[model samples]
Target: MFRISPFIFILIFLTACTLPFNQPILTEGATVPRPQNAATAPVEEQTEPPTAIPDTQTQPTDIQNDTTNGATTDNLEELANTTPADRDQVALVEALTGNDLPEFARTEPLDVQVGDTETFWVSDILNDSNYEVDARLRYAGPHVLMYFETAVDDQIRQEDIDRAAQEFEERIYPRNRALFGEELSPGVDGDTRLTILNITLQGAGGYFSSADSVVQEVNRFSNEREMFVVGLNSFPVGESSYGSVLAHEFQHMIHWHEQRRGPAWFNEGLSTLAEDLNDFGDDNTTILHIQNPDIQLTTWSNNAAQTGQHYGTSQLFMRYVYEQYAQDGGLAQLIQDDAGNNLAAFATMAQQTRPDINSFADIVADWAVANLVNNPSIDDGRYAYSLLPETTTPVDLELNTINDINQFGADYLTLPTGTTTLTFDGSDTVSLTGATPNSGQYAWWSNRGDDSVSTLTRSFDLRDLTQATLQFSLWHEIEYNWDYGYVAVSTDSGETWTTLEGQTTTKEDPQGNNAGTYGLTGISGKPGIETDQGEVGQWIEEQMDLTPFVGQEIQVRFWLIQDDAYNANGMLIDDVRIPELDYVDDFEEADESWEGQGFVRTTGTLPQQWTLRLVKEVGSETIVESVETNEAGQANISVNDGETGVLVVVASTPYTTQTATYTIQSETR
Candidate 1:
């Protein structure tokens, strides 16, 4: 929970909103202070890595998932830092970074030696900024300069300072750079010596200010000099936690030079892991995440529960990634990924390190399962926690407690103890993560409910077609190698099932927690055409071949399956229609009612014109069309196996007012 953000408090409290520090372990190092008041949401999101606003995004917050601008840009920094419950200084810096005003015109900070007195601007977090710290450079290491506030007479013990200084210079400094690379060498300060100012901060253990990373031009509170801030009173001087806190903050300094605008979850995750690599540790916080595994993986909020969960989730994930992927130095490649991203960067790293996976959700899925059983012997260790010991509390789930999981969040659901395979009674998982729809005014989104399935089903008569293909537009990010969104055909009147393969389908062992048992719908330990990995951030056209079943009466059903843990933004099904696949059904809850009367026929002449689907406000001039549906209230769309055609739709004057009125009007020309 060390990574707190100012905006998270604003979003969590509807208006607005750290920990105490610890001593150092000169041997292995101590853990960081329990970062209190971190901004996080039980609502779950990494965009909520996964920012698709719904159609009616009129409000600033859409309850659990969507976090929009509740206030104006002018009030952003103010609101973000105004929450009484959260005086997180780190968040204040995040707010300033978003304004994009300050330019990094290095002020050429004075290079001082050990025993030189200097003053730097420090944020008075409790009082909304403003403070001056007169600190004397106490230790000059080969790689860093440590300073202590001089105002407190005899406050810091000399030996404690010496121990802390020695650790930073001799231990923490070298290990951090060797593992995670350097912290802006000769950075904005134009020197390899990163200024570490130990001042009395308000409520933060410590922070690396992006504002200070740049020279203060438009902003005055900036030290104008490059320095990282750590609280003096928060931690005992000689404490080993210094290694962790300093290492954590140092990573932030390194990241600042990359993407100034980045996801707090990812940034904090890497830094939290930095603590571990520095010999300091996470204080066994993974249990917190294991207990409440449903928090959104990529979002930050200001609160006690979410803050703790975010840190625990992120650190555990990073630990998993580093341990599993670092063996071949792929972890460094992951570090070099686009810093401004969330799951996408992890996805890119996965493609390179583990060829079997292709989505960040894939790693998350494995991590989720591994959290339950931290055994390296299981499934070739693809789903166990090697970062932390296997000694953890057992998972206890209250029935029917799992529901409506958000983007990049995860939930663990258990079937009856003796259950071998998972079959939804009628429930589901799928969610929308982007704003622009694939093709209509709206698309169907399935919330990624754990151990659930979102389905779209209807009877299809493919007896007459020589060649048939079920085509649709979809955007999906499912936990790869573990979860899937697939299409299954039932020819026996809703009795048997066969997974249909499409352009986006792939096969993998989805048995993380469900190992040695059946998990996905059709395939047990084998491969099937499923929405496994890969993050299609936007909607893309895809097709399911139905030509093989051309001479049969089968019920075609679109499905999305989630295992016992890990979630991402659900699938967005836009234009395919078993009578409009947009009418998605949470298969675990109810059967979908896709009401429409249509037949697929192959006639080269009549079917030459492509079908146009129009979603327009009644009597309004704006008509969102799949084809050219502009003039008359008619759409001529007929498709065969030949050349593609366009559908033209024309609206009438019956739709004149725009007061939240919508109509799906399509006619044959």
Candidate 2:
């Protein structure tokens, strides 16, 4: 397992495709077998994070962006430099300005047609305010208002506008509207026609601003127009992917109106799907993802290196979900569901469409299987890609110590060639050692994703114990007062629950004033965890007394809860044991150290081999004999004539999922 850079800053802002989405306010939870104590040392942000595996095979060049397709490529170089901070600040300010709605710049609609010219406030590539433009409406359909930046209108060909308008009115608008639901129509911009301001966007092909849908009498902040800011340079009319960009940006508009709470990954996924649905084109980012599948699916950042993977993988997952489970309008259901984000949104969509699918994990499990083994011919394409061509080249390596492979990501490893037998033992040879506490990362679950819940649980019969003390090595980098990580117990089969406090449990006052503790169980930590510097504090040996329920059978769970706003690696637990019950779990052995989502140390070869080869395991044929492993994580892998043994280690959670594997790989002799 290769160690990607430890620094992954999540952008938790509102922006369209190509712009960094909501960044991690503070996170990931890994099932560390045992993390020795380390302190959170102050550090500066890295220039960029990770070991980006390069593509060995030649990637098919994108034909959509060539000069031949009418796309202006000179300014495409300017795309990556445009930061989302301006849009993020605008959103933050708007949120803070809650209920302070101002009068609309215009109470009525723009009574204009295709040739009408209008002066509109537009942001430059940098989202600077003073870049207003007078734009002529080129395409005024019943549903769309395609405006050309008058400055560049003469340069753009009339044929390109006709081609783009035809797609928008006939293909993009109706198709997306039917699939993703409607954008805010007759909006505060006083227009029924959704505006598509085709300016030369800073670096993005286009972006949707909530500010455009907003209004104020004097404040120049809001565009006070229902519009999407598109770049003339990125998607010159008549370009192949232009309709896709339109479809993509249109989705952000509708999504803003509908499921505003949806996570960036989910929203971006749907937006890309909008492109696919409109018949514009498939997502071009797949090559980036196949080259580096270890990019965390749910976690997002502004880095140019990983941004393509983020979009590519997002489309890959969402498209899989849509293809496999979304039978009766599931995509629409997902966009309409306001309560769900990430896997939660899919869970809701699945429940409504396909009731048999209990959790998103089931889908993820199938999808993971599909990623490694994509055979559309098998099981009705359940374990295959109906849309994407599988282009994974699993990183081949000897068994090395893999520490923090980000969640909802997978690391495919090819065993060294010329090996006859392979063995894996989960004890010392194989274990998920969570990120080094207080050091490179916060805890075992290092850099947890926003709105994620990672849990480690076990059921225990405590009737024999007179007194029991729960003990564990715990470290957390939770957002103070806003997000939480704690130990909770449930006696009624998880129907009801009670939180057990520990040494670090403190009432966090989100406000500066010492407000009532209320239901908020502040930051769970020792005195020094909250340092002036943002690095996580040291790991603490914690205990929560369970003596009160000594006579009953109980279920105990270690939990981490994060909100959508900020970033914080929720919590990490290691060496958990109860004194009276004489039960202990070091997470070293391939057994039930604890039974839950965060970490599973497996026995034999089920977990390891599942992620390894044997792409499809259905009906009578075992792709290859299962490699046998002992109490120690040792696997006996049989290498064929020229084929390499590819081992994949993956874990999925409710909202946030990630890939983590052992440092221990089969040493080919």
Candidate 3:
């Protein structure tokens, strides 16, 4: 159900490209803010080799002066004496490249140091070997650093980086801390620094890499490090767009440090959620998945065709959890719990928040249904939150009564008048002579003490026809005195109605005989009314003439009414036909009175001959009927009476084959 619209995707993609500062931002060296009672433990240092060191041409000895040694008491006093801006700039540089560098950066001596006039440089840190200075920035705030590539400094101005840093420090960092209950700071190993480098990361708009992975090639990059690096796509994405990616990757960094990264779905979902929390707006791709419930959420592969759906569904599922189950810091608790598995972590969180939920599968099933109906009040608000856009609506009935009754096994339709509850008895519990004609696979039984009006109407212009005949097969056992079914018509939709005369009702006697009685017999006087004198095992075919209303735009309706108690086997109507117009029948619900008849319409500029074949399954019998459509594109075909069997109408053309099936009951009367 994930409906993917390329236009919407492109629109969102362009919006992300235009709004750079909307990305989530993290301040360097932010720490998880813990409760007063909860002591903040220091992150244990890991003595592992660097994951991948930058391929730099020069040695990292150019700026190797110890930061603590350089800032003497007199020098500190001088620094304090300077302007506020200069003091803040010096403080930030010290925080980023001081004696305690990120754990990964500490593996090798880093040529990172503050220069005169408050400027700092990390030599060849961006892995851009072509440039001697990989990243250079001027400190803009106590926790913010502004970087602009020297190669594109003319195009990428200092103001852009400063704006990005301001947004990150002001908007993104505090928001994340509020939701995550932690500050974005270095991990326990202290091998890396929280730094945002504006450079082209290979193959992605932005990416987060642990310091350990960046420093040297390690067997695996463990997230249990003090600091990580954020690489933003450095193509002048503006501050908002830049902040969006930062928010996304920052969640990754946080998840790495606070909780062991689970699956790609969880990591991506949380990161995307981070973007939303920072007010970057919901990821449009995720909206697609939220609208479509049929998409599988768990299995995700990078190269799979459904990669976008995977990302979207993951984000939506997490959003649902965050909104429905974990509004009160449960998300943060789950992440910190680090249950070691995604399902286990989710289950634990659900148990603490939604104790009623038994398992993750329950949540999924409820969530899937919610994605369709979205009514929170349903089922005690279990699947209540509406994360998807307002564009989503409830699912329509798969098969409407007018289209295919066999699929529904009953005459079910949304009536214009009001609601009607018609229950079908498909178990063959009530029968005649051991044959369940009235109780075939499908038969609607009226409810006792129920007085309601159920009508099925079809509208069409009959101006072109000289004569119109209404014919149908019926099996009924309504309360003789109070309940009845009638055939009616209207020219003004359902505003007014006129009943057709000569209608009759039939019911099977206790001895399996068709007992016919006049009820509201239509014009033709119930021509084929079976009179076996028992429970009408043999179905009766009736006809009504609509010749008077032939030249007008008219609507025909079948009304079945029941009142008071003592309801019997109600009715089974099938193979209803208005020749030259349409035919509707449910093979599973038909009785012996059903006739193999239907209409086939073909459209072409020229008249075309077509074949209509009626195949009976009992004897493997095939009856082929041929007809030609007029210039107006209409063909009506009627097959004569056939032996009891499954009857199928195959309308064939050179290019198409359309088939409809019905069941003809054995005539026992």
* Reference-based lDDT, each prediction: 0.46, 0.51, 0.39
Runs in model 3 deviating more than 4 A are: 1-133, 144-146, 181-193, 211-237, 339-342, 391-669
Over the full model, what C-alpha lDDT does candidate 1 score relative to the true structure? 0.46
Compose the digit string of candidate 2's lDDT tens values, residues 1-669: 000111211221123234422221111000000001011121232222112211222221221111111211112112112111111212222222222334355667877887889887653322212356788988777777778888888788877887787878888777777887888778776678787788765434566655456553222334667777666665567777567677777877777666544555676777777777777555556656777777777655433345557777778888788777674267777766542343555666656655655555556655765777676665445667656666577665555565445555666656666644555433222112222322221123422443344566678898887878787766554544334566767777765456664555544322211111111122233332321133333455667778777889998876554433233434555567676677766554435435555322221111221223333232443243223344334555556545545565443322232233456545445
Tens-place lDDT digits, model 1, residues 314-371: 7888788877765425544555664224345666666666786655656666666566
TM-scores of the models, in the order given: 0.50, 0.56, 0.40
Q: Order of candidates by TM-score, top first?
A: 2, 1, 3
The digit string of per-residue lDDT tens for model 3 on 172-224 reads 87677666655335333342345555543322344444322322211012223
**What's model 2's overall lDDT?**
0.51
- Which runs in model 2 stand beyond 4 Å of their true positions? 1-100, 103-106, 113-115, 125-130, 157-159, 217-219, 338-358, 415-645, 653-661, 665-669
Q: Which candidate number has the best lDDT? A: 2
Error of 3 at 349 (Å): 2.8
The prediction achieving the highest TM-score against the true structure is 2
Query: What is the RMSD of candidate 1?
Result: 25.1
Task: State each candidate's clash count.
Answer: 46, 52, 59
